[model samples]
Target: MTPEEKLQHLPDKPGVYLFRDTAGEIIYVGKAVSLKNRVRSYYQSGSRLSPKVRALMNRAADFEYIVTDNEVEALILESNLIKEHRPRYNIYLKDDKSYPYLRVTLGEDFPRVHVTRRVVKDGSRYFGPYTSAGAVHETLDLLRRLFPFRTCKQKLAEGVMSARHRPCLNFHIGRCLAPCSGQVGREEYRAMIREICLFLEGRQDDLVKELTRRMNEAADKLEFERAARLRDQLQAVRQVLENQKVLSTSKEDRDVVALAQNHDLSLVMIFFVRGGKLIGRDQFLVLGAENTPEEVLTAFVKQYYVRADFIPGEILLAEMDPQERPAIEEWLSGIRGARVRLVVPRRGEKKQLVDLAAKNALLALQEVEQEQKSRGQGRDACAELARELGLENIPYRIECFDISNTQGEESVASMVVFEEGRPAPGQYRRFKIRTVSGPNDFASLKEVLTRRFTRAREERELIQTGQLSTRQAKFYQLPNLVIVDGGKGQLSAVRKVMKELGFAHIPAFGLAKEEELLFAEGRSEPIRLPRDSRALHLLQHLRDEAHRFAVTYHRQLRTRRNLKSLLDEIEGIGPVRRRALLKAFPSLEEMARATVEELAAVPGMNRAAALAVYRFLRG
Candidate 1:
């Protein structure tokens, strides 16, 4: 049906509406109290729609609607649809990747704690969408040091524990109670797990009280060793608690969200407070923010908390639209299985926290703006380059491929990425030469290009099928333009691979070192830009960086090959043991400096083999 017909037929009940372009792609998604009124409002004369909305209508050709029971359900569905499609016209949460969470396997007989990137419904308790992997590891390390929890995957049933002769070395090191040893009772192990849960949930005061009670009970029973361990754990917990800033005296869990915007950039800072103590803070950067502060905050809160595993009962925000507050809060409260409040603190300690978060967001925005200025907004440069190349689309994300090898020994390739004319080093990837041999640039280029695009397709499929997430897929984001570090032959090879991989629409160019000219597909003449052109310089920077990265990776591979050969000369060292040793000590020099004990600590190695390795390197 035509968009006019769809809008006329839209139901009066609360629901979600989707506007699609000629290609049938959803360009925008929204929910409203009345679908007919909200969807039709866009087309009303003199509506004074924003430029973004006007642009959306310019491309939009059709519309669809889903009737819901109530406004809250419509709001929930709108958030889900926006996250799923990521419509161009909608405000969205940036870096919408799966953050690491601390998972406790409550389903298991003896629960164990570990960090996971995925949240599944397996009766496990999850806490966190930690912003940093390093912070997650630090927390896990502290937990291990303070609590003797098992790390291994040992099944400890009534008969299984009795069958095992001894527990792993963790028991000896006091890092685990080793329930499989048939010594520690299930109740005792479970009690420790409970304490861990409380500690992770940021209920430090309650945890301290529980630990004190347990310590006193152990002392009353004359269990001095257990009492001493409890005493040490208590001291550590107290120290951590003391360091945490007490943000409130209410002991209620809530998230403080505040936003700051400058021009097209927006930053949202959120502070997580539990049991009245400030635990952690995470900030998000939102670009192209064209809405009001209240609208942006509403959009952010909806997008963020939709994927959040745990929703606090109370959410403190600087401002929210009064009309939308009830529906949003109702939706959140449903997710949390409790009544949730959306508070706009006028004056109080909570208001102070909101102000502080806003201050942080402002500071973060300034630093980001400064960094962007230093990098130089390459939008104009990209546009100029696209125009010069006679391309239809601007290359917002450009990926260049380069191969490096020495006589085909230790062959490797590097994929360097630049987004909006700035280097995105985190997206850069290196591939080992696996298929072809010798210093054949064309064949190697074909191989790496083939692998690059092929992996992109695979990761895309994995993400679509719910088997993999966008963040975990290294090759998921395909480039707008491709650059080869060679002339016609290399470009031809890359073009062949791209066609085979069904990505022929993506333009490929080859840069010749001698003339500094670009060779384009289907064009007999090479494109030449002036020496002082910024576009030419940008490509040159990419080519040079790719070469440097690929060469560095090749050298590291060659060093590892030499080290492996040297280790193979030892009588007892086989390929497996050699790889292990090389992996443990990256270089022969480092291995030579390691003592026998250090070498023995490596997996699949004993004191005898460790001594052999030590003597062989020393001799």
Candidate 2:
């Protein structure tokens, strides 16, 4: 149906609306109280829409929507859809890195704790959508030193533990309780888990007090060793607590968010406060941000919290639309499982904290702007190369492909992207060669290009038809230039696929490694640039990056295959035992050097099985 017809029949209920371009790609996503009124307003000539919205509407040939039960549901669905689709018109977060979270495997019999970038709902309790991975590591290290929890991925069932004759190295080092070997009781292990939870929650005072009480009880019962352990833990906890800054007198857990924006860029700073102390801060850079401060903050809050493991008791925003405050508060409260206030403090310490965050945001934006200016030279080189090659558009987005294999074994291809002369690592992709049997570079190149572009074409069609709302289709938008790591033969192979796939307009070239010669699509003679030429350096950078990425993936696959083969050669080492051994010792060298007792400590491995594997390796 036409957009007009769809708007006319739109429901008055709360829902999310999608505006699709003529190509059927969703260019915009929006949530509204009344779908009919919200959608129809866009088409009304008298409505004063923003420039961004006007441009979006002009290209929007069709639209679709999903009806939600209420505004809260609609708000939630909108955030999710926006994250999924990443529509051009939405103010979305675009950082290349994902924040890390502390994951507690609560579903396991003897729970394990670790840091992870991905959060899945499997009865796991995750904490701290920490800004930097380094911070997460530091926190995990501190926790490990204080509380000796098991870090293995082993099954801790009674049957598996009964088969183990001894604990692992971690248990000997006093860094784990050896729950896999039935060395620690479930109640004792669970009590340690409770302490960990309390410590992570920043209830340091309560944790310390509980530890002290337990220490006193142990001493009264003449358990000097247990009492000494508790005393050491209490001291470590106190040391960590001393490092935290007491920012608020009210002892309220809160998050202070602020942003600084230019016409094209925005920097958001979030300060995490727990138990009246400032724990840490994170900053994010958002590209293509032309929205108002209120709109940006609103979008940031929704996107940020959806992935956040913990929600603060109060969220203090630098700016937010008054109408959106209640809806955001309701949505956050539901996710947090408690009442969460969305506040815009206008006075006193709260306001001061927000101001401090804003100041940090501004400083971060300035640094990023300066860095971009320095990288402008690389972008200029791309523009120069475009003129030299007589291309229709400057190669702002360039994708390079390389193939790696060791004698046709573990063949793989890597595609690396450069945007505005800087590497966009998030867009980097790896493909395992499937169709081509051996190390046929030409055929392998053709197969990889076909798969890449075919999917891109399919995604483009789906987006234009409004059939697909979200896509991580890196190839959906064709790169302005393609570089393959080889001579004219590889270039010809890739070009043939591009032509067949109707992507011939994308200029492709091959950079021969030895001579550093560039072979264009139709040119016979190689074009040689000066050794110090910026364009040559840029091309070389891209080619080298692609080669590096492909080799890295190739090595990873080879290592896994080698490990599997080695394990298969050992007697009584089935898939389960093989997996456990690999999980315990990732490298073959590590496994080969492991003692029988160490190998036996792996869950599901009995002494006999461990001895067999150990003897096979030693032999």
Worst 10 residues of 1 by lDDT: 163-172
Candidate 2: 10-residue stretch with minimal lDDT: 157-166
Candidate 2 yields a Cα-based lDDT of 0.86
lDDT by residue (tens digit), candidate 2, 1-619:
7776776788889999998888888888999999888898898673688876777777888889999999999998998788788888888877523767899888887899999877788999988677678888998998899998999787776445753556766775568888877787777787889899888876777788889998999899998988898898888888988989888887888999999998867889999888888877888776553688888988888888887767888999899988878888999999899999988999999999899999999998899889888689878989877876778889999999999999999999999999888899989999999988878999999999999999898998888889875454566877999999999999999999999999998899988999999899768789887788778888888999999999999998899889999889888999999998888888888888888878887878999999999888899
Compute the lDDT of residue 69 as modeled in candidate 2: 93
TM-scores, each model vs. reference: 0.68, 0.64
RMSD for each model, in Å, please? 6.7, 9.0
lDDT of 1 by residue, 1-619 (tens): 6777776677889999998899999988999999888888899664698866777888988888899999998998998898889888888867666578889888877888999988889999887777668878888998999899988876666445763555554665568887876768778888999999888766777899999999999999999999998998899888888888988888899999999998766888999899888987888776544777888888988888887767788999987888899999988888889999999999988899899989988998888788878566587778888999988999989999999999988999999999888789999999998999899999999889888888999999999999999878999998999999999999999999999989999999999988999999888999998899889988998999999999999999999989888888888888788877887799888899988877876667778999999999899
Clashing pairs in 2: 23-464, 24-463, 24-464, 24-465, 25-463, 25-464
